[model samples]
Target: MKANRFVTVLIVLVFLVGGLFAQGQVERKAVEVKVLAGVTGGKDDTENALFEKEMEKATGLNITWEKPPSGYDQVLMQKLGAGEVYDLLYLNQFQMYALANQGALTDLTSRIAASSVYSENVDPDELAKIQMNGKYYAGFNKLEVFPLVNVNKAITDKVGINLNTLNTLEDYYQMLKKVKNYMENTVGRKPYYPFFTYMPDIWDLQPWFSSAGVRRGVFKDASGKKYAPFVQAQAKPVWEWLAKLYREGLMDPASFTGKTGDMRNKMWQSQEIVMDVDWAAWTGLYNNNAMTAGTYPHTVNVVGLPGTKSPSGTFMLEQGGASLWAIPANAKHPDEAFKIIEYMATKEGGLLLSAGIEGYDYVIQDGKLAFTEVGLAHAKDHGAPFPISTQFDLGVLGTMNPGVLESVAIGKRADVEVAPMGYADGELDARKYYDIMSKWMTDCIMGKMSADAAMRGAENELRINSLID
Candidate 1:
């Protein structure tokens, strides 16, 4: 009888333990989501792997990433055209707008609005943005714009140049010329540094144009008539300014196309570049690197761009959010997709996305956050601390740009706001128009053709494209 009782007790314990195990397993839903343009990490990397392991446990998500190096553009486009199945689609601005217009994207309006988890995780004002044609079709990350002129004070002080007083295109050009002449006369003919924009992409030139009261290739006059940014009278000063930089050898040739960030960074790190157009955060990062290298790097002063009227107002990229994640109209697991997106959009999720696991990737010491040495080094190569929402930055980076907020040196120049781009003057295609103006701008800056010739060519293209009508 005693032996029978012992056996009965053992059997009961086995059932209890198994029941608990089953319950725990039930708590975590096994979600396998194929996500495009998700975070790409090295498969063999210990840190990324660890983070992913923890993230899976926390979010109950196993994400399969799409291809990289070129991203999911081509494959996605092909699949989208073929009407293939996908749960969520990550799109660029053009893609989001175009696809949504074609009814390929599902309207996320009701689901996102009703989601308490989503609402609490992001900013209060963010919901207003993500809307196109008054309907929310996607989710986006928030971004802030603080355009600054990162300059080396050592060079400027030596040249007896004061950047504070400098405004307008002519002022900047002359100052760069002075810096160039002084550098060559004192250091050597090596052209160690001159005036250089950081990335030099067409989009990067937005700062100068914004400062000049022309936002996104259009300027509205007192009558509110919109005119193209490349018009001769309006573009002359902008072109003339850059032309001098290129023609006089003051601006790096790479500035026209903006393909020389590596060379620019090397020069900046060595305290050789005089002026650099960079954001406060990255500027501070480079400055810190220079300091650590014992380069005696000059103090990088932040200034407003030339001809900026409202220097206080910087161009905010995607005032709505960073990248927009949209669900396809024909997605199978729409609810599951939203679950992942909502989780990723939360503060907890954002923290995980940006800083990674605390002990491995970063550490909090005395109420301050710092990246581990490995994390810091890896971050430089991997990319910025990417939170799904731009509002949550890598804590370490937030510390770097304290001075940026304090410096309100941008003059109250005219504020140029770019409304959403549409078919300009009923022109079905504005791409050729952009191409023409871009070619002109390039030609003018490279001195391959004068601004007049460039403008004439642009106008001819505009006419041929039927944009003038």
Candidate 2:
């Protein structure tokens, strides 16, 4: 009887130990995740590689990155429609809205609220961007600053234009005329045209429209009960300005139909365009590298265009929010993925990804962040690699660069002042309005329609869309 009892106890002990071992094995396995990310040239070659390496090192999670062919929205819609499981998904404003409206994305309001990282990192105003009916759906990566007008110093000097005093609309036109004449008479070539305006994209129109105090298509009246359409009123003056420029040959003809990539190539490679509006980050990267390589004629300087109001006023509609890192609703290992996102937002993780390992990638000197030679080369070549979207949870306020902030100087001018309109939600579908206005605006600019007729047509279309209702 004693021997049998002892054998029974031994058997039970073995079973318990085996069960524990099995559980441990399961826990040790890395969480498998598939992520869809939009591919930019720099991202494919550099940032993605570094992100993969760092994420693996920080968390044992293995991630598979996928790029959708063609439109990201179409790919997402198809995948969700087919019930395909994605561990994580990167979404732009349009994609976020479409998915949210379809009930495809999980509501992350509670999760974000519960997270110490999120609560600490996000600001009240920045948090507003992700909210729909007070529920948070998505996060932003980095706040997109207002577009900067980049000028070639050589071209400006050649035309005898004073950079500082060119602060009015009339002054700008005069400068462009001077450059056009100088190129025609002296160089026997266009030294540089006045502006390379990309008309096909709505973002290209933002600066001009905003400068005229036109806040999108909708603005609330004083009573708050009525919302007035700004486009009809504002487009008149703005389109007139554009028409004047077009007639004088100050604006590039290619701008009306060329793709953004084509426009960029013309500006950078041909060096025939003097002024173009682009994101400060992109301009910085291009100018920095081009100058370093000795391929560019002069260092590109960022200057603010003349605004109707204060320099910052022209930028009131500018979107400022955090980009988010989120696990998909169907994620197999949600907890593990969240932990990885958490780590990435930490100071150590940010430094590792942004600056890289200190001794090897960068070093602090005289209390300033200084990049090593390798780091400098990497920055010049790779640009910002880590998904800054994850860093949104860090709650750290970032200062704009001097050049970028300088572009806002016009916003501060005494003659210029920003009149606040309501929030310009990036994700909302203003497609119908955009389509109608774009068609009419193009027609008006091309002299196919009168400004008054275009304005009337736009009002009728807005009413039909129930925007006024």
Best-performing candidate as measured by lDDT: 1
Error of 2 at 269 (Å): 2.7
Candidate 1 lDDT tens digits, 1-469: 9999999999999999999998876554345555555333322357556755665666666654443445467878877788677777677555776788888888888898898876766654555544565687777532223344556666788789877766555676788888888878886757644767533334445445544445444334556454565564665667667777777787776565555465346445644556655543445555555666655444443333333333445432112113567888887767877776676676666666555667776788877667787656555222124444534544444454323433222321234332333333222344665666667677777888887887777777766665553
lDDT measured at residue 298 in model 1 versus the true structure, 0 to 100: 49
Model 2: per-residue Cα lDDT over 400-421, one tens digit each: 3324345544434455433322
lDDT of each: 0.58, 0.57
User: Which residue pairs clash in candidate 1?
Assistant: 141-321, 141-322, 211-308, 309-412, 309-413, 309-414, 310-413
TM-scores for candidates 1 onward, in order: 0.71, 0.71
The C-alpha stretches of model 2 lying farther than 4 A from their native spots are: 1-34, 39-50, 59-72, 119-123, 143-146, 190-192, 217-230, 292-324, 330-335, 343-433, 462-469
RMSD per prediction, one decimal? 8.3, 7.6
Stretch of 10 with least lDDT, candidate 1: 405-414
Q: Give the TM-score of candidate 1.
A: 0.71
Model 2 vs. true fold: TM: 0.71
